[model samples]
Target: MKPFSKLREECGVFGAALRSGEAAGLTYNALLALQHRGQEGAGIAVAREGAVFCRKEVGLVSEVFDGRALESLGRAGLAIGHVRYSTTGQNICENTQPMVIEYLRGRIATAHNGNIVNALELKRKLTEHGCVFVGTGDTEVIATLIAYEALRAAAPSPDPGTAPADPAPSALSAPAAPDSAVEAAVVRAAKQLVGAFSLVVLTPDKVIALRDGTGFRPLCLGRSAEGYAVASESCALDSAGFTFVRDIRPGEMVVITPEGVTSRQVLPAARQGFCVFEYVYFARTDSVLDGQSVYQARYEMGRMLAAEHPANAEVVCGVPDSGLEAAAGYAAESGLPLVSGFVKNRYIGRSFIFPSQAQREAAVRLKLNPLSFNVAGKRVVLVDDSIVRGTTSRKIIASIRAAGAKEVHMRISSPPFRHACHFGTDIDDEKALIANNMTIEEVARHIGADSLGYISPAGLKTACVHGSLPLCMGCFTGEYPLFVGRHTKTQLETR
Candidate 1:
């Protein structure tokens, strides 16, 4: 058992092409801003002098990348970085990203967000074609597929002397015009892939940003004095001192070079399936994804939750990090006083890699402690983002009760998580989820809460400011945006 009760956000990817600032250093800062997306592993790959220099390890960004590691990456024109939580792979260094590779054409390093639906089938086919893998991670698999396709698209027919094939005359067909071919190859590879993905790929001269056709994951483009930056959230862009540009639309790819930026729509315009949970939990409250402010959306979620599930409590307090915004909304809507019920340790990283469930449960108290002075003898309304296994919640409630809280009403900002998330969340299989088998009342009892209330499905939808963009609610609804199913979360890691 993973010992985590909340769904883990998969990965955060950041890419930059800079004219002045060092790509690696600026990206390190960007990763720090985007670290909440994942804490299992961290990595950065820089394209320097046409070869890639990379340093990656399984740990939080700060813990994994030391001053020497940053120095090893040095400065480069183009760089890509990733902070990962293992949705598709296991928590291991081999699964850490910024998956770099070499091919007949040149070097390309890629950092990816989102999971591939057909990764297992793709791996089988690639293996039969003589591709050997170092680790069972979809990011590495994707990098290999892109490299192979790029080489294939650029390769010409063999000659009698066994020399490389000659190129045609047009700009698009010319061999020396390498970036165009690579971009086209990337677009082709993107078309072949199914399911959600947001990729930031780095070559020697350019940084490429891509989003899946349906845009199940967030990827946005921004501009800086140095050049361009692409990240999982606009907050990372702001951290890098970049001006917010529009999102890299679904099915779109942008190639950024010293000459400027060029765009291509690989897939036709379609309904956007932007992840709604980004606003609900994963994204920075400051980020605007798909034209909607995440903070405003979360505030709306709190208001909606209050409208549907009103509680008679003296004070409302949200979970330390993401739930805070919603907590404010709840307080404003219900006219109840809001106060801090628990104080979290800012230095403690997410315990995704704890060796055992017992250790993880024990470590929970170290990360968050109840404010006995505030919570004592009060009817406390505890708000949190979506919960799964109920292990962590039980711990939190037990501590609060031990501190002399009179009543604890558990309120979730999102609906019950009954289904597995196949896109990028690590929640997989009904057996692992307490909600899959237990009713809301049963769950409240299991977690030691006095009462429990969840935001309804419609309430969750209307809470987002994503006006017309369709959102992926598959995890709560048991309906997927894409056409793939039955695969296990750890299967990719097992390979």
Candidate 2:
């Protein structure tokens, strides 16, 4: 079992098309801003002189792409990068992305965020047609799919020495236009995908960006004097010194080249299923997703949580990182003093893979230590994003009690996590979910909290009302925006 009881999103993706300067360095900075999304692996692929060069490894962004590695990629006008925490494949170097594939047309590098639900089906078909895979992750499947479509579009007719099929004519794909065939291929490949995905494809001449029909993941456009940038969140754009442009609309595909940018409606708009957890936990607080401020959303969640489950405590304290903003809102709404209850060690990464239970329990303190001065002899209301399996919560509440807190009343900012997330957020097993087996009171007792309260689903939705799209509350409500069936990470990675 893992030590930390938290959900994990799959990956963060970034792409840049610059008129001057090396894109690899700018992409590195963007990945750093997005490091919160994933830490298991990092990669960057640069398109240079009709060739693609990529460096990827199973480690954090800074660890994987040191100065030497970044320098080795050389200066390039187009680049795409990824930071990954595996939801579909094992955490190995082979699965680390910005998957660079050499295709019939040329070389293209692709970075992806979000889960592809029908990956297995697609992979089987591709395999039957003699496509061999070197990586187990779905991203390779997606990249190959695009390459296959592009090859199909450019293939000659079956008849004797006939000319190749005309590339489907559209505003973006004018007949006989070789440059736009890749864009058409992207559209065709996107139509076959069944779940959440935001893709950035780096070709020698241009970068292409696409989002799912339902917009289950976030993707946005950015602009600089040099050129355009694409990222999973607006915070990365800010980190890379780019101005936030409008979000790439649901089902929209934007092609960025040195000449400028053009867009095509790759997939028709489905029911807007923007992942609500982006605001609840997955995103950086600084990010703006689909026009909603993640910080403001969390603040409102805190306010709503206080209204719905006001704690009888002398001080309000949030779990470090994600909980701090909500805790501030809780304190403001409840008229309680907001206090720092824990000092987090910034160096420790997620403690989810300790070898033993004893070591796992001990690792909790290595990451966060209670500030005994603030909590001692005070009734403390502890706010957190959510409790996954209750292990970390138990450890945290125990530490607060040991610190001489009079009481530790736990308040959760989001609704209970009950179902498995099949859209990129990692949940080990639905059966392992604490809420699946325990009642609210039982969970509170299990976590050793004096009292516990969870914000209602309605409250969570209201908290994120600034969002332009409808929310996907699948994990909380067990009713996904699209068909998920009984898919699991284990199943996806098994073969």
| Cα-based TM-score, every candidate | 0.92, 0.94
Model 1 weakest 10-residue run by lDDT = 160-169
- What candidate 2 gets wrong by more than 4 Å, as runs, is 1-4, 155-177, 349-356
- Model 2, range 80-182, lDDT digits (tens) per residue? 9999988888888878998877754467778899998889988897777667788788998898777767644444434311223333322212222244666
Q: What number of clashing residue pairs does each candidate have, in the order they appear?
A: 0, 0
Q: Using alpha carbons, what is the TM-score of model 2?
A: 0.94
Q: Using lDDT as the measure, which candidate wins?
A: 2
Candidate 1, residues 393-474, lDDT tens digits: the string is 8888888888889999988898888877778887777787888879999999999999999988899888874644688888
> Which ten-residue region of model 2 has the weakest summed lDDT?
168-177
Runs in model 1 lying further than 4 Å from the true structure: 1-3, 155-177, 269-271, 350-362
Top candidate, metric TM-score:
2
The TM-score of predicted model 1 comes to 0.92
